[model samples]
Target chain A: MIFLSTLPGVRAVKNLRVLFMGEMQRLQRYHIIAASLVVAVIWIGVLHFTDVDDVTSIFPLLLFLDATSMSITLIGVSMFFEREEHTLKALFVSPITKGEYMISKIIGNIVSNLQTLVILYLYAWFFKEINLNIFLLVFYVIVISVFHSMIGFLLAYRSKSFTELLTGVLKYMFIFLIPVVLEQVGVITGDLLTNLMYALPTKAALLLLNSTTNGVETWEVLYGIAYLIGLSLLLSVVIRKGFEEFVAKESGI
Target chain B: MFKVENLHFTYPKNKEETIKGIDFEIREGEVFGLLGPSGVGKSTTQKILIKILQDFEGSITYKGKNLKDYGRDFYEEIGVGFEIPVHFSKLTAMENLQFFMKLYKNHEEPDELLKKLGLYEDRNKKVGEFSKGMKVRMNFVKALLNKPKMLFLDEPTAGLDPKNARIIKNLIREYRDQGGTVILTTHLMNDVEELCDRVAFMADGKIVEINSPKNLKLQHGDRKVEVEYEMGEKLESQMFSLDDLKEDEEFFRVVKNHRIITMHSKETTLDDIFIDITGGESSEES
Candidate 1:
């Protein structure tokens, strides 16, 4: 019978751990983790038949897509499901802060997404002999996952249903990922387009992933890290500030 | 204990205020019912008290400290049961309860609660598969999982069968007897009469009436007694002023000489009072 008021920080941390574990368990029970693994396996199967040179060029893009876009979509889908079931209202009354709840969701989603990325990376390493900078890949995974999770939260907050959320994700992909797609297909080139695209978080994430998998430029790596870190920090602040407002509405207050 | 003074609130999107300068105090270890019609700010007031809808205009003191001063720790001492079921549909009842139980600093054995509510056998079943009554019972179990000092129940027994509703009502009384306070908001007058120590009727964002159920009934009831008697192969009734019942010869004669079928004081019910005090226009869904 510990009094939560006596040690607020300790209580919050404990509740955060509980919430994170519960979220992860839900992910597993819903077979979301298995589905993600299947998607990774599908990617591996497709890449197994491709040319080695093509695999080198395409693998990083596929990994980046899984880390950022797929993570964002999965988070959005999970939130919409929770909203539909009214499960979040239970969380709203619990002895946990909005910050704690948001962090738990982000961390839980990141953990599951990272598992998929690891499986895909291992398969590529053993079969395709593709070696990437593990440190850079992990860094990009964390930064990109967090940034896109926040974006997912914002989208889910505005959406009223899963179909609407899917529409929002599609719109987000078209608007934000266009520059990255054009760059990947060799349709866009030069320092001007690259510098312009670096302003977008997606492009910055791709730059980091590309630098890790292909070859690296010192300045590009430095700029990509700095840009992604700054963007993630900004998104974190915005999401933390807006979380209460979003939850209040979602709770039917 | 909770004390609220001059509380005022207006939704940002609405031009008019929702809760306007309301005042009330809930004593420790008492069941306080806040009753009103729909759109009369009952839910808004509850939200403000629960710290969900902030930016209110007045002061609320819980345990002698301003509610605004409290953080997430405020929830540690209180349990809130929403009017609607709020469990994860895909998860079993036991899983949902276990997850929520871990979020609390103090946890209760949920199995006992589920058993008390007649849901023990279905604890491992997903909530989505449950009937509406079962879901309502699960919601109550979730609210009490933390062993809270105070409980805020919104329609706690709505959609429940009489037997299950009786179980919930008894549990609430047991909680109160064990020194827990409760703030209940519901339109079910029978529950209010059976459980509340005091009730406030809110309308147009103001508490128009506040008193114990017995006191309210006395204040509004007719001060007379009605007697029904079988006379000459027909049933007849008569009303006598309660103030002079002993002295009134006719009343005495009827009681002594007539074959009295039934007799009762003409007292108003809490339901009638609720309708009268709240203008009976808006539905009682709030």
Candidate 2:
């Protein structure tokens, strides 16, 4: 039933599995787990401060958890390892097309993000957000994780070096994470929030979470999901083309 | 199996062409060396041959068809072990092999390959902890996993220890013995000397010389042979031209009256011949 590769059985599937396995093990480190756990704790603390006491609100943080740190971290880490191992040369030599390789990477990231999503869902259970709507929640998690992974892929492709990719993501955070956090906090405090948050991906995922858990029928949730799928697809095309160009020009043997 | 004709390639921003009009052919079963010092277009040529560098001005015909027509499938028939190793550092050695093995239409057992390179014991360890030589061995294993018809090796032994390097060289030989073609690029004269059935020396993007390593050495070599022997309780030496020495009275006297110890042809090395033909002092790189 598994015919993932043109080659036959699970060759492509195996490669995908390996890519995911490697990335997951990297995130299994104490420091990485501690950092993510701390993020979860801070989200809980924020819920207490706001007194909204809605556990569903924290759903957006998973998107933030993956997009800001996990995907960005994985891509940066992969690039650094490629440089150190000099493995891109091997990839260049293989029969696998650049397009195929990039797809494998995206699929790998999505699979690995499953673990992160499960952890987030576990945290949501503590707040009475886990319910019969689990299937819808799963769909949301998959879509959002994929969307952020595409963003990270684009980010990594644009940066010339690993350090450069990291700094670029940090700069992107300046433009992205801060505004969404402020807008969410404003909404919690019943203050006027900037509509600029509408453009942020974090806001889209958060809106989806708010609607799914709280059963809100606001247009914001639909708009956010649509925005995420559209943006993720657009970014996938852009980054794939960008990566093709990068391989063509980068002269390292 | 492949023929590259009048190939010309230049990077977009560079004024100078990196590969200037070179022609070469690799028959079905032979080890062909692209010998040159660093930046002499060896890697550039490999990149072009492997279809990594396009916008080339000439034609590359594989089995009488345009390489462009084949697309990524062309890689299925060719196994390339780069001069550098490529793997996910966080993954184990077996994991790297297992991933690459799936990319090919055909396959072999990674366990057997790992054992061949003495990497089986460490197959489960993350590649991050592997030494440089171990990574090189794994790279070789990756290349062989598909059982390719043509192999491209760019200084495949640069970082390996002597024993491992010898094993790789032998594998290249065995691959050729099984009717595989090889393209090896390196400045290591010994590698070219030992493995190459034919070699082309490049400098600044043009092949200045091409021939069998033995022929190149012989053509440019000193025509004299150095003979060492003991005569009258003293070590003696004599130089003789290989052209005609069968009837030389002095040579006969030395061989007849003295005990011959060691005699070697005064042949120039492949590197010396490369320097002579390419007319450039080899720089430290490759």
Candidate 3:
């Protein structure tokens, strides 16, 4: 184990694990996990009362809503708690890099989203007729969660308060998320609008989640996968660069 | 352990430099105090030293290497105790300490530290439920948990009772005795006087004076002694130059012939020196 630490990349991984565990512990202790479970229960309520017997079609929709919107909101909530408590200052001075901090938070949010996935999937499997591939759903949920988590970081960096963060999330939902969601529910329809939805990360996220249940065009699936992954990587770079400024702001520079 | 030379820095939005060409050295295994009033750049200097605000136009070397050259690993060798409480309120004290402790390759035992700080019984209590003083003590423990070679403490005893403050000061002294370096920043001149081996007084974005506390007192103090003697119902006081004490027979005559109420050299206090050198209020919390 000591020799492994002497190799490159091992120490960061070790620190990442420590930070990830801390994140999870905070999520539980801060009642963030309980809050997430409560939201899961709400989604289960929506599933139980739906008219359809075979709820495979709506499973991805609920998961998509959870993974995308909840991912962003939950990450924002956790970060705002850290900010309010000034724990971020403590973490800043620790022997961990910003990348590790960011990735640990993203991974922690993924776990919360996955927990919701499991609860919802199990409910669908036992109580209703479902025909989706669970493994593919897990994979899609992870991707969607990661992309939105990065968006959470961006909004968090620019927000001055929890209220401000919620405002930013609302603006994002109106601009990126609500449009795609409206189109998915057949509220808006046009080739131009449909093509424009392809340009948003949220659209790619919903596409990836929807592909799990029904057969999507192969190119669309590839586009959705490539788009979200590519956008997440781009957002990661932007976040990493912006983190120094954020740290300076948080440090009261 | 650290040398800062001609350091100058301005916030991106500000027109004036916050740290204007300040120079100082923090000796290894010694407590160095950075004393100043509000907005005079003591914290800015510390932030620079700790690698928090790095966009500065000067040179700082940690252990003879450029501070810029050091990466995140630099934090492995140091710990910071913030002036404000910075712990997860919902988490237990032990949990907070353990989380931070695991980030370092080397660490002191948190249980022993909590016990020393009178916090062992409350280790499992959530930090949100802790008293303000308890939280302050917990910050000190978190700073020491990593067994860091250098400690950067900002108002470590700001919100503690005398007994708890004494515990923290003694632990700081013990840490120094055990070959740890400390950079202390506080408006509490008493803490500075008790713990600092050397102190720098800052004002207007510059280090105006830097020396040992004793030397500063001696330099800024009177070279005379005062004698207050009781003569019947009235108190008569006289001053004598300390340099000519051996040659002055009148001082001895008063000492022998009168009832002495008080007699002492007029060495100044750190609070007075802080005021004189920094041109700021004496020992007022910032």
- Candidate that scores best on lDDT: 3
C-alpha root-mean-square deviation, candidate 3:
1.8
Q: Any residue pairs clashing in model 3, and if so which?
A: none
Q: How displaced is residue A83 in candidate 1, in Å?
A: 1.6
How many clashing pairs in candidate 1?
0
lDDT (tens digit, per residue) of candidate 1 on A183-202: 88888899888678877888
TM-score of chain A for the candidates in order shown:
0.90, 0.74, 0.96
lDDT of 3 at A38: 98
**Positional deviation of B243 in candidate 2, in angstroms?**
1.3
- Scanning candidate 2 chain B in windows of ten residues, the lowest lDDT window is B277-286
**Which candidate should be chosen as best, given DockQ against the real structure?**
3
Better of 1 and 2 by DockQ: 1
Better of 1 and 3 by lDDT: 3
iRMS values for every prediction = 1.6, 3.4, 1.7
Residue A15 shift from truth in candidate 2, angstroms: 6.4
The positional error of residue A223 in candidate 3, measured at the CA in angstroms, is 1.9
TM-score of the second chain in each model? 0.97, 0.95, 0.96
- After TM-score superposition, the amount by which residue B139's alpha carbon in candidate 1 deviates from its true location, in angstroms, is 1.1
Candidate 2 root-mean-square deviation in Å: 3.8
